[model samples]
Target: EAGVAQSPRYKIIEKRQSVAFWCNPISGHATLYWYQQILGQGPKLLIQFQNNGVVDDSQLPKDRFSAERLKGVDSTLKIQPAKLEDSAVYLCASSLDPHPDRNTEAFFGQGTRLTVV
Candidate 1:
């Protein structure tokens, strides 16, 4: 009955610093996702995981961003040498199923807003 959970609702860092965010998906959900949202832009999928296995991460910036789903439950996203462009909200979402064609809707957590000075 509970929804996804995220930590550190807000963060501020200077450019080139490192930041990390945490997420805990809803119970019974097998599909978890991490997204980045810049102001005025829609959420961009950074990575996706199905039961601890990576399903997709094509859009993730491998040079500076990384993510992992541990034991098919909790997840973490990190950005090293953060740039000013990385100032955005980091969102976590989870769906009950992994199949995209399924009608299940994803539940989102309160995003962590990162500000790079």
Candidate 2:
């Protein structure tokens, strides 16, 4: 099966600017997630979608970060007025929602690396 896909594997932007990342999950998967992975830290859940409906986004910083998975297939994440502390890897993962805990075997893409100056 095709795996998750992300773009602009690397990016460099100045602080207070804006940047966006994209993701395409595997086919037939019903659950998608976005995570921010800072250097030396594990992936932190940012946003989660289940069939186009938001399941979890409590960890997302609404002040500067936003995301959408309109059709439950492809998704986009944007960071406006970026900060120096925002430099990190944005990882997208997808899984088939087949369990009660909503935890399926998620597949990760080669994340987008952002560098804020």
Identify the candidate with maximal TM-score: 1
Candidate 2, residues 17-99, lDDT tens digits: the string is: 99999999999899899999999999999999998999999999999999999888999999999999999999999999847
The global Cα lDDT (0 to 1) of model 1 is 0.95
- Determine which window of 10 residues in candidate 2 has minimal summed lDDT: 95-104
Q: Which residue segments of model 1 deviate by more than 4 Å?
A: none
Query: Clash number for every model?
Result: 0, 0
Q: Candidate 2 local accuracy as lDDT?
A: 0.95
Q: Tell me the TM-score of each prediction against the true structure.
A: 0.96, 0.95
lDDT by residue (6-104, candidate 1, tens digit) is 999999999999999999999999999999999999999999998999999999999999998889999999999899999999999999996767867
lDDT of each model, Cα atoms only? Answer: 0.95, 0.95
Candidate 2 lands at a TM-score of 0.95
Model 1 clashing-pair count: 0
